[model samples]
Target: MNEPLCPAYSVLRLLSGKWKPAILYHLREGSLRFGDLRRSLPGVSQKMLTAQLRELEADGVVVRSVMACVPPRVDYALSSLGLALLPLLQQMDDFVQENREFFPSEEG
Candidate 1:
């Protein structure tokens, strides 16, 4: 079998965590504040969210902006590279929905 190239491997490494894809998906709608993202992802802990956001930012896929105000405000949005993944992610979502039988549910 042919080995995958380094660039593809790097992207996979960046997106390896369970929360990464969901975080990316949420960011698709537009910028979201830290608390907003946390609320959207019900089960994610604060630490995990922070870690994942940092990772995504480091990977150049997500942009983090901090606002100076009465209370500190942080927002996350997809970087250009990250926005490029939307169509692909949307296609994947459609595929999963269309092929639901192929992916068994845990409840079953």
Candidate 2:
């Protein structure tokens, strides 16, 4: 077969997961504490969230900051590259909103 697509496939691989898009979507709002992120995604487990964050960080799309205080606060925010995806994400959101009727709802 032809050589597999490089960067495009790579990006899709990086962002393809049940939780990665959701995680990225929430981060678009700004940096958030781990607890806050977890709260935003009610069904994600702590271990899964940690793993996804680590993966995103490794992929250069997420930044993790830790404050060396008594409680040792930790927060996550998007990197420049990740921020670049916002407009695309917003467009995707708009498309979904505009075409909601075509998508099946869980309640149904």
Candidate 3:
């Protein structure tokens, strides 16, 4: 019997969540203001977004910047380490596009 298809489980151990991918996907375009990110990701509660952002920040995949202003604006963007992941993410996107039909969806 084949032991298991995915023998390596540590990778999943590092990024274990539903929203991380969405957050990363959003950062692919470049910097986004905190409110913009929240608006872009519909259905994500403030609590969840805050939690995911904090986790990504801790993982060094996202940078948080605060601009001095009357209200002190905050922004998020991919860091050097985060940019390093672009190729991998883009490759994944390409692969999915190449074989998208393998996974069907209700949405057109």
Candidate 4:
């Protein structure tokens, strides 16, 4: 890459965690409410999702908004930099699907 990857590689170091990619993939579809994301992502615990989101927010890859309302709403969405990563992530998803059977489940 850039002699030895860009400085952003440092950002990727944090954002490249397991749930981080999944979270980013979901946000690529559109902004999602916290509950919706928790539900969409299959086995993630509330604590893990919250932690990953906070880390991504700190890396400037995602944005978090808090709405002032009776119930109070918060939503998560990708920033421009995050959006730029979508095509690459989509490619990875497709490749995974093609070889999905290779990755067996632990329950089996």
Q: Lowest-scoring 10 consecutive residues by lDDT in candidate 3?
A: 7-16
Evaluate candidate 4 by giving its C-alpha RMSD to the native, one decimal.
3.3
**What's model 1's TM-score?**
0.86
Q: Report the lDDT tens digits of candidate 1 across residue range 2-107.
A: 6767666866786789899899999998999999999999899999999999999998999999899969888899999899878877887899999998988856
Clashing pairs in 1: none
Residues 45-84 of candidate 3: C-alpha lDDT, one tens digit per residue: 9899999899889888899999999898999998887787
lDDT of each: 0.90, 0.90, 0.81, 0.86
For model 4 the local lDDT of residue 87 reads 80
Estimate the TM-score for candidate 3. Answer: 0.80
- Tens-digit lDDT string for candidate 2 (14-57): 78778999999999989999999999998999999999999999
Candidate 1 wrongly placed segments (more than 4 Å): 1-7, 106-108
Q: What is the TM-score of each candidate against the true structure?
A: 0.86, 0.87, 0.80, 0.78
lDDT of 4 by residue, 23-107 (tens): 9888988999999999999899999999999989988889999999979999999999789878877887788788989866658
Clashing pairs in 3: none
| Clashes (N, CA, C under 3 Å) per candidate | 0, 0, 0, 0
Off by over 4 Å in 4: 1-8, 97-108
The 10 consecutive residues of candidate 2 with the worst lDDT sum are 1-10
Q: Give the poorly placed runs of model 3, Cα more than 4 Å off.
A: 1-14, 106-108
RMSD of each: 3.1, 2.4, 4.5, 3.3
